[model samples]
Target: MNILVLCTGNSARSILGEAIFNQLGAGRVRAYSAGSRPKGVPHPGALRLLERRGIDTNSFRSKSWHEFTGPDAPPIDIAITVCGNAAGEACPVFPGTPIRAHWGLPDPADVDGSKAEVDAAFEATWLALTARVAAFLALPFEKLDPRELADHLAEFGRMEGAA
Candidate 1:
């Protein structure tokens, strides 16, 4: 199955989600990312965080959602919005009847302060997405129907960090 994770910037949360899903899904699922408004580059802190986890950040780039709407574009099995702004905005109509879900995370790029503080924000977001993606991968995909899978994905969106 092919999945597209969307956000406003396509720089941090969506990028991290794509990488995590791609890694955990193995060959069972392929993941892609796009944004309502491209940031033109992956966020530096996001790159650092992924690198620290041993995931390559070289292939990531911010891209517009329009790329997924064309005839030659890959048909998306699922499209998940990973931030509040992107979830609220009107998205490009995907070729297939793509299942939509929201897995909103706090925007690490929006966090301000020292370099250490910024890195901490990105790390926290990464950990949150990693946990949710791990839960998603644990689901029995072969047995559940597409709608059920979408429902479960949405449930992942609502999870809060352990206090």
Candidate 2:
């Protein structure tokens, strides 16, 4: 499966989701992330958090969803929105008519506090997204029809830390 995660900024939550999905899914799925309005850089806090967990941070960047519109772009099987702003905006049509779901999450970049507090917020977001991704990875995707898969994914959106 190929999944695309989206957020307005694509700097924090969506980036985190992308890393988690790629890390956990490995050979089962390929995950990418983008923004409606690209921030041009991944959030530093997000980068630091992923680095702490030993996930490769070299490939991450804040990119526009428009990049996936080309014929050469990888077809997406699913598209998930991780922030309310991006979830509410109209997204570009992905190549494969990917299933869509919203897993609204608080943007760790929006958190305001000491450095530790900010890092903690990023850690919490990472944990929540990881839980959701693990649940998704546990599903019998090969056997489930699109409708069943969509329903299960929707349920995953309601897990802890849902925004």
Candidate 3:
């Protein structure tokens, strides 16, 4: 399945979400991340964290949602918004009827303090994403219809620390 993770900034949470899904999906899913208003680059802390996880951080970049809306774009099977702003905002029409889910996560970059504190916040967000992603991947994807899949996806969004 092709999955797209969305956010307002495409810098932190969404970027992390993209990485976790791609890593844990085990080639069963192809995941991408984008923003309504991109920061034009992935957050430095996000890159550092992904690199620590052995993810080749070089390929990740903050991009716009429009990239996935074009005729040539991949047919997204699911679209997940990882922040409130992107969840509430209207999105461009994707190539297919992608299952939409809102997994609102607090922006780890919003923390104000030393580098260690900021990294801690990012780490917490990463763990939360990992939990949600793992749970979703555990689902019986072949048996669930679109409605069932969407509902299951929404359920993941409501977990503690996700909102």
Model 2 bad stretches (over 4 Å): none
TM-score of decoy 3: 0.98
Task: Give the C-alpha lDDT of model 1.
Answer: 0.90
Identify the candidate with maximal lDDT. Answer: 2
User: For candidate 2, lDDT tens digit of each residue in 44-152?
Assistant: 8999999999988889999999988899999989999999999999899878789999999888999899889999999999999999999999998878999999999
Residue 29, candidate 1: Cα error in Å is 1.0
**If the candidates were sorted by their lDDT against the true structure, best first, what order would they fall in?**
2, 3, 1
**Model 3 C-alpha lDDT per residue in residues 94-122, reported as the tens digit of each score:** 98799899999999989889888888899
| RMSD from true fold, candidate 2 | 0.7
Q: Which regions of candidate 1 deviate over 4 angstroms?
A: none
Clashes of each: 0, 0, 0
TM-score of each: 0.94, 0.98, 0.98
Error of 2 at 41 (Å): 0.4
lDDT of 1 by residue, 47-107 (tens): 9988988998889999999999999999998898989999999998889899899988889
Report RMSD (Å) for each prediction in the order shown: 1.8, 0.7, 0.7
